[model samples]
Structure formats: structure tokens, C-alpha cells
Target: MATPPSEYAMSRTPHFQELRMASGSDNLQGCFHLLFTQQYAEIDGLINVLCEKRDDLFKKIERMEKLVEEGEGLCAFHDSGNVGLEFMKETLKTDKKVLAALTGLLDMACEGRREKRRHVSRFE
Candidate 1:
């Protein structure tokens, strides 16, 4: 399983803390902006990794379907091939939703950053 971006971000706290410590109060905001930018990059990477995992799972499902079709209607691993198929379908559906939520989160975060930049630029 892939580690979530939020959880992975925690591991980067020390680096951000170092940046904060190195900066004066006036530059605190700049440090935070950098943090957000780095986080966006990480989230983007996470999305790519998840998409790859999803693709691999889809390939596995195709292989499983072929195997079940060749075998008697019953699955050796699962009680019935049909049941296993339905299970994988449902699992994929759930994963699809999760991926959508993650993408939405990334979109919202990016939008917020853009808005903040616009607001700041107007004053400068």
C-alpha cells in the first residue's frame, strides 16, 4: 500500500522547521509558501504513484478473470469466481472514489495557493 501524502508530509516537518528557524519573522510567510509548494509537488507525485498502482491492479483483475474463466466456475482462492469478480469490482469502485477525493484535495489546495498569490501581488 502507498503512504498517504499527508502522512508523508509529516516526515518533512523537520526540514520546514529548519527553514523557519533560519528565517527572520518577516520571512516566516515565505518559508510557509515554500512548504506549501513542496507539499504540492509531493501530492502530485503521490497521485502518479497511485495511478500506476491502479493500473497494475486492473491488469491483475484481467488476469484473474481469464484464470477464472478457464477454471470451473469455482475459484480456488475464493469460494466462487463470480463472488471474487464482484468483490474486485466493488473494491475498484471504492478506490476510484478515494482517488477522486485525493485529486479534488490537490485541486483545492492549488486553487487556494493561486488565490493567495493574487491577493498578495495586488498589495505589492
Candidate 2:
């Protein structure tokens, strides 16, 4: 019997934590702008990682579906597959929403850095 993926696989990855830490520090306006740029880069990396994970998740689901079909409508490993399938559905939805939020944050951060540059240029 093939074991399903652990929920930990869908957890906040290491890059995610690094981004949080990088974005939380206080510094000068110039330094903050640099950090924000770095944050955007990190966010892009995180998004790519998430996309890969989501692809893997979908493949896992497909395998599960095949197993169920092979069982001829009865999952011998468990009484029913509904619980696991529903959980995966919810996880996928949550993952997508998180990605959307991260994208929005990246956009906001980029705009903020641009505005800061504008302010500095105007003062010079």
C-alpha cells in the first residue's frame, strides 16, 4: 500500500520563514527599499516552490484516484476515501489563496519601494 504525503509537505517552507524574517526587520529607508526588493525576489522563489508542490499534490491525488478505481469502489485500506479527498480539496484551496495573498503583498512592496525612490529623487 502506498502511503499518502504527510501534511508537513504542505507546511511553510524554509524560504517562507526567511522571507518573513527579512520583511520584519527595521532599517533605514534606503536599506528598507533594498530589503523590499530582496523580499520580492524571495516571494518569487517561494511561489515557484509552491507551484511545484501543488503539482506534486495533484499527482498524489491522481494516484489515490487510480487506487480507488482499482479497488472496484471499495477502498480496502480505509472504509472510504471521501475524508482524505475532501481534506486535499480544502488544502488546495487554502494553498491557492495563500499564493494570491503573497502575490498581492509582493505588488504592494514593489510599489512602496518605487514610491520611496521617488521621494528620495525629489529631495535630491
Candidate 3:
């Protein structure tokens, strides 16, 4: 059977109010702790990702250096071909353009590497 509201039920009963307060406090504490724990976990994950990105950038720089070295070797070989320099002056001019283009590309690659390092450093 349903009971009618007592004076204590309609008003703030001390015992019931204290129980509610205690439970609320406990719940609030648990929520704050969980929030802090999640924040720490996210921070750790971000650090790991940053480290991996830095490693990847370093690998890219290594690859670019290798490419530049290979390009330089090819340019050297072209310049050293059997034909006399005077006879191939026009051809050498075209070769110079190719070398210049390769150099510009290498410069861009180096700049990209530098920018990546800067970005990764800031994240760290």
C-alpha cells in the first residue's frame, strides 16, 4: 500500500539529506579521478605518436640525402662523358639546366626536412 507523505518526507529530513550528500560527494570524487586518468592516458598517447612521427621524418631525410647523392653522381657521369667539352658545349648547357633543376629539388627536400624537425620539436 502507498503511504501518505509525512512531514519529514515533504521537508528536508536530516538523515536522508546526509545520505544524499555523502553519495553525491563520492560520485563526484570518482568522476574527477576518472577524468584525470583519461587525460593522462591521452597525453601519453600523443607523446608516443609524436615520437613516431619524428622517427619517420628522420627516415625521410635519410632517403632524400640518398637521392641527392645519386643525382650528383649521375650529373658527374654526364659531365665526364667521352666527348670533348668544346664539342659538347651546347649539350653541357642543357646538362647544367638539369643539374640546376636537381639542385633546386634537393634544396626543397632539405627545407622540408628542416620544417618537419621544427614541427616535431615543438610537439616534444
Candidate 4:
């Protein structure tokens, strides 16, 4: 029944979408229903989109770093000349592996939630 994203009235940001069903049922007069939903598959799509963006940015950064290193000639061998280069490369590698593993995890979790919600007795 719950979770994720935004645009305009809700910008495209990562956030859990909480749907409070105030009157979907008449029997629950004084109680409110709480559910989580991702309006446009936002939660399911977040990781892919985010990873793609980060991968692109990292590529651009890698290109720039390459240029800087080439310009530095022998300085590229010095640790001080390329402070975070190795770290950024490692991050790029980790992101690729992590993204592959995480791609549909949110979707699976959300489906489980939907299954549980559907089984809940409507009268309780």
C-alpha cells in the first residue's frame, strides 16, 4: 500500500508516497487508512534513472580528469596531482554492480506490500 517520487506539485525527488485513504470505506468511520504507493513507478524507476545519471556524470568527470592528467604529464604519477581519481573510479565500478543488483528490489518489496494489503480484512 505504500512508497516513492515527485514532479511539479511534487518534484522528481526520492520520497515515499503515503496515501491516507480518508474515506475509501464507510465502515471505518473514525479511522483512517494508510497506504504507500508510487504514483508513476517512481520508486521502481529511481535506481535505474539515478544510476544512469550518475554514470553519465562520472563519465564526463573521467574524461575531464583524463585531460587534466594528460596535461600534467609526469605529474599524473604523483598522488597529489590526482587526489580523488582512484576513488571516483572505484565508485563508478561499485555503482554499476550495485545498480544491477538493486534494479528491481523496490518493485518486489512493493508487490509484497500490495499482496499483504489485499489480504487484510476490510471489516477490521
Candidate 5:
């Protein structure tokens, strides 16, 4: 009977000579098992490194989202202040009252912007 395909292939390769000699087997199963185990270990290590990098990227994305939220809050605050200033100027029509309200609105807006900046800077 002709030799099995695995034996025939192994017998033709110079690399398997030592394994064949050491195992004294025609199947070469031991050589295949050792190679597979080594490859699996390498793949496991690579997967762990990839998982760590994914977690780091997730944290960075969360930080960026927080900064964007802070910026949006600041923009909304400024828009509301502008609306209030326009309304005061139209309805009051008195220079002194309008100026006083405008000054207060500006002070509040500046304080809000500064608070937002401080919050966003924490993420950086």
C-alpha cells in the first residue's frame, strides 16, 4: 500500500526530518501540535495588545465628547445673552437702563465662558 499523504509530504521535507526522527512516528502529529500551540500563544498576545489600544481609544473619544458638550453649552449661553440684549434694546429704549442690562449680561456671559474653558481644559 502507498504511504499516507501526510507521511509522504513529511518525508519529502528537510524541515520535518528532526521531528520525524525524534517522534519516530509516521503521522507527525506531535510536530503539528507544537506548531499550533506556539501560533495560538502568539495570536493571544496580539489580541491582548489590540484590546488595550481599543480601550485607550475609547477613553480619548469620551474626553473629546465632554469637551464638545462644554463648547455647545457655552455657545447656547452666548446666544441667549444676545437675544436678551436685543430685547432690552427694543423694549426699554432708554440708554442708561439698556447699558446697565447689557453690562450685566456681558459680565455673566464672560463668567460662563471662563467656567466652560476651565472644564474643557481638564480633559486636555
Candidate 6:
């Protein structure tokens, strides 16, 4: 049966020490120790890669949050600008109506003066 990882770790420590002390030879325990050491190195490398990827993901999330805030600010600015534009348009419409009324008043005054001139000339 395969040993559990925790038990294998415990068992491998003493064997690793023994393998280090012994001369390089065809020893089964030494071979197993070397294999376990290689596997542990590979696992450590994978863990480092995973940590790097996690940090990159966090940075991307922060950037997205900042972008969202900027988008909201732009939307608010545009809404206020639209409201100001509408107010200006309404003011312009009122000003046009006032100008038209003033023009009509000036025309009536000139027409009344002409009628007075004609009546005065008829009397002379």
C-alpha cells in the first residue's frame, strides 16, 4: 500500500540523512531518497508559480476597480453637463420669444407715427 504523504515525509528524513552519509552506490533507500527529493523540488517550484499567478490576479482586480470608479465619475459628469445644456436651451427659447414681442411692438409704434403724419398733412 502507498504511504500517506505525512508518514512518507517523516520516514524520508532519516533515510535522506543516511543516504548523505553513505558512499554513492546502488542502495535502494538512497534511490528512494533521491526520488523524493526531486519530487519535493518540483512541488516547491509549482507552489512558487501559483503564488506569482495569484499576485497577478490581485493586481488585475485592483486595476478593474479603479477603471469602474473612473467610469462612474465620467457618467456623473456627463449627466450634469446634459442638465446644464437643457437649461441653456430653455433660456434661449425664452429669449427668442422676448425678441419677437419687442420687434412687434417697434413695428406698431412706427405704423402709428406714420398714421399721425398722414392726418397732419391732410389738415395742412
- Ranking the candidates on lDDT from highest down gives 1, 2, 5, 6, 3, 4
Q: Which residue pairs in candidate 4 have backbone atoms (N, alpha carbon, C) closer than 3 angstroms, thus clashing?
A: 1-36, 2-36, 2-37, 3-36, 3-37, 4-17, 6-10, 6-11, 7-10, 7-11
Identify the superior model by TM-score, candidate 2 or candidate 3.
2
Number of the top TM-score candidate: 1
Clashes of each: 0, 0, 0, 10, 0, 0
lDDT of every model, 2 decimals: 0.58, 0.55, 0.50, 0.47, 0.53, 0.53
36, model 1: CA deviation in Å? Answer: 0.4
The segments of candidate 2 whose C-alpha lies over 4 angstroms from its true place after superposition are 1-80
lDDT of 6 by residue, 2-90 (tens): 33235565477776545544525344445455554554455456545655654565565556555555555554478575565555456
Give the clash total for candidate 5.
0
lDDT tens readout by residue for model 3, 1-124: 3343366763766554444344443343433444445444554565556556555655655565555555554555676543443334544455556555555555555555555555444433
Q: What residue runs in model 1 are displaced by over 4 Å at the alpha carbon?
A: 1-17, 21-26, 73-124
RMSD values, in order shown: 12.1, 18.4, 17.4, 12.6, 23.6, 41.9
TM-score for each predicted model, relative to the true structure: 0.44, 0.39, 0.38, 0.32, 0.42, 0.40
TM accuracy, model 5: 0.42
After best superposition, candidate 4 residue 114: deviation in angstroms?
Answer: 13
Which 10-residue window in model 6 sums to the lowest lDDT? 20-29
Error of 1 at 124 (Å): 12
| Cα misplacement distance, residue 21 of candidate 2 (Å) | 27
lDDT of 4 at 73: 70
**Span of 10 residues, lowest total lDDT, candidate 1:** 1-10
lDDT (tens digit, per residue) of candidate 5 on 51-78: 5655565565555555555555554468
**Over the stretch 25-78, how does candidate 4's per-residue lDDT look in tens digits?**
322211223222332245446545655765675676567567555645755677
TM-score of 6: 0.40
